[model samples]
Target: MSKQHVHGSHPDIVKRLKRAEGHLQRVIAMFAEGRPCLDLAQQLHAVEKAISEAKKTLIHDHVDNCLDDAATGGPGKSARNVLAEFKAISRYL
Candidate 1:
Protein backbone atom coordinates (compact mmCIF):
# COMPACT_ATOMS: atom_id res chain seq x y z
CA MET A 1 0.00 0.00 0.00
CA SER A 2 1.05 3.57 -0.63
CA LYS A 3 2.22 5.62 2.32
CA GLN A 4 -0.45 7.83 3.84
CA HIS A 5 0.31 11.51 4.12
CA VAL A 6 -0.33 13.44 7.32
CA HIS A 7 -0.25 17.16 7.95
CA GLY A 8 2.49 17.56 10.52
CA SER A 9 5.84 19.40 10.60
CA HIS A 10 4.08 22.40 12.07
CA PRO A 11 5.46 24.84 14.63
CA ASP A 12 3.82 22.98 17.47
CA ILE A 13 5.48 19.72 16.47
CA VAL A 14 8.84 21.42 16.30
CA LYS A 15 8.36 22.93 19.75
CA ARG A 16 7.39 19.59 21.19
CA LEU A 17 10.49 17.95 19.69
CA LYS A 18 12.69 20.61 21.24
CA ARG A 19 11.11 20.06 24.62
CA ALA A 20 11.54 16.32 24.26
CA GLU A 21 15.19 16.83 23.47
CA GLY A 22 15.61 18.81 26.69
CA HIS A 23 13.84 16.06 28.60
CA LEU A 24 16.22 13.48 27.15
CA GLN A 25 19.22 15.57 28.13
CA ARG A 26 17.98 15.69 31.70
CA VAL A 27 17.51 11.94 31.63
CA ILE A 28 21.11 11.53 30.56
CA ALA A 29 22.26 13.76 33.37
CA MET A 30 20.24 11.81 35.84
CA PHE A 31 22.00 8.64 34.73
CA ALA A 32 25.40 10.32 34.96
CA GLU A 33 24.76 11.60 38.48
CA GLY A 34 23.62 8.16 39.63
CA ARG A 35 20.17 9.37 40.54
CA PRO A 36 17.84 7.11 42.43
CA CYS A 37 16.18 4.46 40.30
CA LEU A 38 12.68 5.45 41.36
CA ASP A 39 13.31 9.13 40.57
CA LEU A 40 14.76 8.30 37.20
CA ALA A 41 11.87 6.01 36.45
CA GLN A 42 9.40 8.73 37.30
CA GLN A 43 11.13 11.23 35.03
CA LEU A 44 11.25 8.71 32.22
CA HIS A 45 7.57 8.06 32.65
CA ALA A 46 6.86 11.76 32.39
CA VAL A 47 8.93 12.00 29.22
CA GLU A 48 7.04 9.11 27.70
CA LYS A 49 3.72 10.70 28.55
CA ALA A 50 4.77 13.99 27.03
CA ILE A 51 5.86 12.31 23.83
CA SER A 52 2.64 10.35 23.63
CA GLU A 53 0.56 13.47 24.10
CA ALA A 54 2.49 15.30 21.42
CA LYS A 55 1.96 12.44 19.01
CA LYS A 56 -1.77 12.43 19.67
CA THR A 57 -1.97 16.17 19.05
CA LEU A 58 -0.21 15.82 15.74
CA ILE A 59 -2.35 12.87 14.70
CA HIS A 60 -5.55 14.66 15.60
CA ASP A 61 -4.54 17.68 13.56
CA HIS A 62 -3.73 15.49 10.60
CA VAL A 63 -7.03 13.66 10.85
CA ASP A 64 -8.99 16.84 11.03
CA ASN A 65 -7.23 18.60 8.16
CA CYS A 66 -5.21 16.39 5.87
CA LEU A 67 -7.17 13.17 6.17
CA ASP A 68 -10.46 14.97 5.88
CA ASP A 69 -9.32 16.51 2.65
CA ALA A 70 -8.13 13.21 1.28
CA ALA A 71 -11.37 11.43 2.07
CA THR A 72 -13.27 13.25 -0.65
CA GLY A 73 -14.20 11.44 -3.95
CA GLY A 74 -13.37 8.02 -2.57
CA PRO A 75 -15.27 5.02 -1.21
CA GLY A 76 -14.29 6.20 2.21
CA LYS A 77 -10.89 4.66 1.53
CA SER A 78 -8.93 7.57 2.87
CA ALA A 79 -10.81 7.46 6.14
CA ARG A 80 -10.23 3.76 6.38
CA ASN A 81 -6.54 4.25 5.73
CA VAL A 82 -6.30 6.86 8.45
CA LEU A 83 -8.10 4.59 10.90
CA ALA A 84 -5.73 1.73 10.05
CA GLU A 85 -2.73 3.92 10.65
CA PHE A 86 -4.11 5.02 13.99
CA LYS A 87 -4.69 1.41 14.96
CA ALA A 88 -1.11 0.47 14.09
CA ILE A 89 0.27 3.37 16.11
CA SER A 90 -1.98 2.50 19.03
CA ARG A 91 -0.15 -0.81 19.30
CA TYR A 92 3.08 1.01 20.13
CA LEU A 93 1.40 3.31 22.63
Candidate 2:
Protein backbone atom coordinates (compact mmCIF):
# COMPACT_ATOMS: atom_id res chain seq x y z
CA MET A 1 0.00 0.00 0.00
CA SER A 2 1.08 3.56 -0.60
CA LYS A 3 2.18 5.42 2.50
CA GLN A 4 0.31 8.46 3.72
CA HIS A 5 2.00 11.83 3.46
CA VAL A 6 1.50 14.03 6.50
CA HIS A 7 4.30 16.57 6.35
CA GLY A 8 3.18 18.76 9.19
CA SER A 9 6.61 19.38 10.65
CA HIS A 10 8.79 18.91 7.63
CA PRO A 11 9.56 22.54 6.98
CA ASP A 12 10.23 23.41 10.58
CA ILE A 13 12.52 20.42 10.93
CA VAL A 14 14.35 21.36 7.79
CA LYS A 15 14.96 24.86 9.05
CA ARG A 16 16.33 23.55 12.32
CA LEU A 17 18.56 21.05 10.54
CA LYS A 18 19.91 23.73 8.29
CA ARG A 19 20.72 25.91 11.24
CA ALA A 20 22.62 23.04 12.80
CA GLU A 21 24.46 22.45 9.54
CA GLY A 22 25.65 26.07 9.51
CA HIS A 23 26.85 25.73 13.08
CA LEU A 24 28.71 22.54 12.17
CA GLN A 25 30.50 24.32 9.33
CA ARG A 26 31.57 27.09 11.68
CA VAL A 27 32.86 24.50 14.14
CA ILE A 28 34.94 22.88 11.43
CA ALA A 29 36.33 26.22 10.41
CA MET A 30 37.12 27.11 13.99
CA PHE A 31 38.97 23.83 14.43
CA ALA A 32 41.14 24.51 11.41
CA GLU A 33 41.95 28.00 12.68
CA GLY A 34 43.46 26.67 15.94
CA ARG A 35 40.79 28.25 18.11
CA PRO A 36 41.10 27.84 21.86
CA CYS A 37 40.10 24.39 23.13
CA LEU A 38 37.56 25.78 25.58
CA ASP A 39 35.84 27.89 22.91
CA LEU A 40 35.82 25.00 20.48
CA ALA A 41 34.29 22.69 23.08
CA GLN A 42 31.55 25.24 23.70
CA GLN A 43 30.79 25.51 20.00
CA LEU A 44 30.74 21.75 19.73
CA HIS A 45 28.26 21.60 22.60
CA ALA A 46 25.95 24.01 20.79
CA VAL A 47 26.12 21.93 17.64
CA GLU A 48 25.33 18.78 19.58
CA LYS A 49 22.40 20.45 21.28
CA ALA A 50 20.95 21.71 18.01
CA ILE A 51 21.22 18.27 16.41
CA SER A 52 19.76 16.62 19.46
CA GLU A 53 16.83 19.02 19.49
CA ALA A 54 16.20 18.34 15.81
CA LYS A 55 16.23 14.61 16.45
CA LYS A 56 13.80 15.03 19.31
CA THR A 57 11.51 17.16 17.20
CA LEU A 58 11.47 14.63 14.38
CA ILE A 59 10.80 11.76 16.76
CA HIS A 60 8.02 13.70 18.42
CA ASP A 61 6.40 14.43 15.09
CA HIS A 62 6.64 10.82 14.01
CA VAL A 63 5.20 9.47 17.23
CA ASP A 64 2.39 11.98 17.26
CA ASN A 65 1.36 11.54 13.63
CA CYS A 66 2.01 7.83 13.22
CA LEU A 67 0.46 6.75 16.50
CA ASP A 68 -2.56 8.89 15.78
CA ASP A 69 -2.86 7.21 12.42
CA ALA A 70 -2.72 3.78 14.01
CA ALA A 71 -5.27 4.67 16.69
CA THR A 72 -7.67 6.92 14.88
CA GLY A 73 -8.98 8.14 11.55
CA GLY A 74 -6.24 7.58 9.00
CA PRO A 75 -6.20 3.89 8.01
CA GLY A 76 -5.24 0.39 9.09
CA LYS A 77 -5.67 1.18 12.73
CA SER A 78 -5.62 -2.40 13.81
CA ALA A 79 -4.06 -3.63 17.04
CA ARG A 80 -1.27 -5.14 15.00
CA ASN A 81 -0.41 -1.79 13.50
CA VAL A 82 -0.26 -0.13 16.90
CA LEU A 83 1.89 -2.92 18.25
CA ALA A 84 4.23 -2.65 15.33
CA GLU A 85 4.65 1.06 15.88
CA PHE A 86 5.32 0.55 19.56
CA LYS A 87 8.01 -2.00 18.82
CA ALA A 88 9.53 0.26 16.22
CA ILE A 89 9.82 3.24 18.55
CA SER A 90 11.34 1.18 21.33
CA ARG A 91 14.74 1.54 19.76
CA TYR A 92 14.68 5.20 20.65
CA LEU A 93 14.47 4.47 24.36
Candidate 3:
Protein backbone atom coordinates (compact mmCIF):
# COMPACT_ATOMS: atom_id res chain seq x y z
CA MET A 1 0.00 0.00 0.00
CA SER A 2 1.00 3.58 -0.52
CA LYS A 3 2.74 5.03 2.53
CA GLN A 4 0.99 8.37 2.52
CA HIS A 5 -2.16 9.50 4.29
CA VAL A 6 -4.36 12.59 3.97
CA HIS A 7 -4.20 13.58 7.63
CA GLY A 8 -3.77 17.25 8.47
CA SER A 9 -1.69 16.62 11.60
CA HIS A 10 1.58 15.88 9.81
CA PRO A 11 2.77 19.46 9.71
CA ASP A 12 1.81 20.05 13.32
CA ILE A 13 3.54 16.90 14.38
CA VAL A 14 6.67 17.89 12.49
CA LYS A 15 6.69 21.26 14.19
CA ARG A 16 6.31 19.61 17.57
CA LEU A 17 9.13 17.19 16.83
CA LYS A 18 11.36 20.04 15.74
CA ARG A 19 10.64 21.84 18.97
CA ALA A 20 11.49 18.70 20.87
CA GLU A 21 14.69 18.37 18.87
CA GLY A 22 15.69 21.86 19.87
CA HIS A 23 14.98 21.08 23.49
CA LEU A 24 17.08 17.94 23.24
CA GLN A 25 19.95 19.85 21.70
CA ARG A 26 19.80 22.40 24.46
CA VAL A 27 19.71 19.65 27.05
CA ILE A 28 22.82 18.08 25.55
CA ALA A 29 24.58 21.41 25.56
CA MET A 30 23.56 22.09 29.12
CA PHE A 31 24.93 18.73 30.14
CA ALA A 32 28.26 19.50 28.51
CA GLU A 33 28.32 22.96 30.13
CA GLY A 34 27.93 21.45 33.58
CA ARG A 35 24.51 22.88 34.23
CA PRO A 36 22.77 21.91 37.43
CA CYS A 37 21.06 18.54 37.60
CA LEU A 38 17.61 19.93 38.33
CA ASP A 39 17.63 22.34 35.39
CA LEU A 40 18.91 19.68 33.05
CA ALA A 41 16.29 17.24 34.25
CA GLN A 42 13.53 19.76 33.66
CA GLN A 43 14.62 20.48 30.11
CA LEU A 44 15.00 16.79 29.42
CA HIS A 45 11.54 16.19 30.75
CA ALA A 46 10.13 18.85 28.45
CA VAL A 47 11.80 17.22 25.50
CA GLU A 48 10.45 13.83 26.50
CA LYS A 49 6.93 15.14 26.89
CA ALA A 50 7.05 16.98 23.59
CA ILE A 51 8.17 13.84 21.80
CA SER A 52 5.55 11.75 23.55
CA GLU A 53 2.82 14.18 22.59
CA ALA A 54 3.91 14.24 19.00
CA LYS A 55 3.95 10.45 18.90
CA LYS A 56 0.46 10.33 20.31
CA THR A 57 -0.80 12.80 17.74
CA LEU A 58 0.73 10.90 14.86
CA ILE A 59 -0.59 7.57 16.08
CA HIS A 60 -4.05 8.99 16.58
CA ASP A 61 -4.06 10.50 13.11
CA HIS A 62 -2.98 7.18 11.65
CA VAL A 63 -5.68 5.28 13.48
CA ASP A 64 -8.38 7.76 12.60
CA ASN A 65 -7.48 7.85 8.91
CA CYS A 66 -5.69 4.67 7.95
CA LEU A 67 -7.38 2.11 10.18
CA ASP A 68 -10.78 3.65 9.68
CA ASP A 69 -10.31 3.65 5.93
CA ALA A 70 -9.14 0.06 5.89
CA ALA A 71 -11.97 -1.05 8.09
CA THR A 72 -14.42 0.65 5.80
CA GLY A 73 -13.18 -1.30 2.80
CA GLY A 74 -10.47 0.94 1.51
CA PRO A 75 -8.52 -0.55 -1.35
CA GLY A 76 -5.72 -3.06 -0.79
CA LYS A 77 -6.33 -3.61 2.92
CA SER A 78 -7.71 -6.44 4.99
CA ALA A 79 -9.12 -6.83 8.49
CA ARG A 80 -6.15 -8.88 9.58
CA ASN A 81 -3.75 -6.24 8.34
CA VAL A 82 -5.64 -3.47 10.04
CA LEU A 83 -5.79 -5.39 13.28
CA ALA A 84 -2.10 -6.14 13.11
CA GLU A 85 -1.28 -2.56 12.44
CA PHE A 86 -3.49 -1.43 15.28
CA LYS A 87 -1.83 -3.92 17.60
CA ALA A 88 1.60 -2.72 16.52
CA ILE A 89 0.77 0.91 17.12
CA SER A 90 -0.91 0.28 20.48
CA ARG A 91 2.46 -0.63 21.93
CA TYR A 92 3.46 2.99 21.69
CA LEU A 93 0.55 4.00 23.86
Candidate 4:
Protein backbone atom coordinates (compact mmCIF):
# COMPACT_ATOMS: atom_id res chain seq x y z
CA MET A 1 0.00 0.00 0.00
CA SER A 2 2.71 2.47 0.98
CA LYS A 3 4.79 1.52 -2.08
CA GLN A 4 2.45 3.58 -4.21
CA HIS A 5 2.88 6.93 -2.50
CA VAL A 6 6.37 8.30 -2.15
CA HIS A 7 6.55 11.78 -0.63
CA GLY A 8 9.01 13.68 1.54
CA SER A 9 11.46 11.13 2.91
CA HIS A 10 10.02 7.95 1.40
CA PRO A 11 6.72 6.24 0.70
CA ASP A 12 6.93 3.87 3.62
CA ILE A 13 8.08 6.57 5.96
CA VAL A 14 5.29 8.90 5.00
CA LYS A 15 2.81 6.10 5.27
CA ARG A 16 3.96 5.20 8.75
CA LEU A 17 3.80 8.82 9.81
CA LYS A 18 0.30 9.26 8.43
CA ARG A 19 -0.86 6.19 10.28
CA ALA A 20 0.76 7.47 13.43
CA GLU A 21 -0.94 10.81 13.01
CA GLY A 22 -4.29 9.09 12.74
CA HIS A 23 -3.56 7.06 15.85
CA LEU A 24 -2.45 10.15 17.72
CA GLN A 25 -5.60 12.00 16.80
CA ARG A 26 -7.67 9.06 17.92
CA VAL A 27 -5.79 8.94 21.19
CA ILE A 28 -6.48 12.59 21.73
CA ALA A 29 -10.15 12.07 21.06
CA MET A 30 -10.22 9.10 23.38
CA PHE A 31 -8.70 11.21 26.08
CA ALA A 32 -11.38 13.77 25.57
CA GLU A 33 -13.98 11.02 25.89
CA GLY A 34 -12.46 9.53 29.06
CA ARG A 35 -11.26 6.34 27.44
CA PRO A 36 -9.55 3.57 29.40
CA CYS A 37 -5.91 4.05 30.26
CA LEU A 38 -4.91 0.56 29.13
CA ASP A 39 -6.38 0.99 25.65
CA LEU A 40 -4.95 4.46 25.35
CA ALA A 41 -1.55 3.18 26.32
CA GLN A 42 -1.68 0.49 23.65
CA GLN A 43 -2.70 2.91 20.94
CA LEU A 44 -0.10 5.37 22.10
CA HIS A 45 2.50 2.64 21.84
CA ALA A 46 1.57 1.95 18.25
CA VAL A 47 1.76 5.63 17.45
CA GLU A 48 5.15 5.87 19.10
CA LYS A 49 6.48 2.92 17.16
CA ALA A 50 5.18 4.31 13.89
CA ILE A 51 6.73 7.71 14.51
CA SER A 52 10.01 6.07 15.52
CA GLU A 53 10.08 4.01 12.37
CA ALA A 54 9.41 7.13 10.31
CA LYS A 55 12.26 8.94 12.00
CA LYS A 56 14.58 6.01 11.34
CA THR A 57 13.52 5.89 7.72
CA LEU A 58 14.09 9.61 7.27
CA ILE A 59 17.54 9.33 8.80
CA HIS A 60 18.31 6.35 6.64
CA ASP A 61 17.36 8.30 3.53
CA HIS A 62 19.53 11.22 4.60
CA VAL A 63 22.49 8.94 5.10
CA ASP A 64 21.87 6.99 1.93
CA ASN A 65 21.53 10.08 -0.23
CA CYS A 66 23.36 13.02 1.34
CA LEU A 67 26.14 11.18 3.14
CA ASP A 68 26.61 8.73 0.33
CA ASP A 69 26.89 11.56 -2.12
CA ALA A 70 29.37 13.35 0.11
CA ALA A 71 31.43 10.23 0.50
CA THR A 72 31.62 9.35 -3.17
CA GLY A 73 31.92 12.44 -5.30
CA GLY A 74 34.30 13.62 -7.99
CA PRO A 75 34.20 17.34 -7.17
CA GLY A 76 30.64 18.17 -6.19
CA LYS A 77 31.11 17.61 -2.45
CA SER A 78 33.40 19.58 -0.21
CA ALA A 79 34.75 18.99 3.27
CA ARG A 80 32.77 21.96 4.50
CA ASN A 81 29.59 20.65 2.91
CA VAL A 82 29.96 17.18 4.38
CA LEU A 83 30.95 18.54 7.76
CA ALA A 84 27.92 20.83 7.84
CA GLU A 85 25.61 18.03 6.86
CA PHE A 86 27.14 15.72 9.47
CA LYS A 87 26.69 18.39 12.09
CA ALA A 88 23.06 18.81 11.11
CA ILE A 89 22.48 15.09 11.46
CA SER A 90 24.22 15.10 14.83
CA ARG A 91 21.57 17.44 16.22
CA TYR A 92 19.04 14.63 15.83
CA LEU A 93 20.99 12.65 18.42
* Best of the candidates, lDDT: 3
C-alpha positional error of residue 8 in candidate 2 after TM-score superposition, expressed in Å: 1.4
* Backbone collisions counted per model: 0, 0, 0, 0
Q: Write the per-residue lDDT of candidate 4 for residues 1-93, one digit (tens) a residue.
A: 455523357877767888889889999999999999999999999898888878877877887777777778736778788878878886774
Would you estimate the TM-scores of all the predictions?
0.69, 0.82, 0.88, 0.73
Better of 3 and 4 by lDDT: 3
Which model is ahead, 2 or 3, in terms of TM-score? 3
**Predicted candidate 2 versus true structure: per-residue lDDT over 1-93, tens digit per residue:** 997765789788889989989999999999999999999999999989888887777778877888767777677678778878867875764
Better of 1 and 2 by lDDT: 2
The collision pairs in model 1 are none
Instruction: Give stretches of model 4 more than 4 Å off.
Output: 1-9
Displacement of the residue 21 alpha carbon in candidate 1, Å: 0.9
Q: Name the TM-score of candidate 4.
A: 0.73
Span of 10 residues, lowest total lDDT, candidate 1 = 67-76
lDDT of each: 0.76, 0.83, 0.92, 0.80
lDDT of 3 by residue, 1-93 (tens): 897555799999999999889889989999999999999889988999999999999999999998999999999889999999999999998
User: For candidate 1, lDDT tens digit of each residue in 1-93?
Assistant: 998653555678778878988998999899999999999999999888878878877767766665566566444466678678657755654
Arrange candidates by lDDT, descending.
3, 2, 4, 1
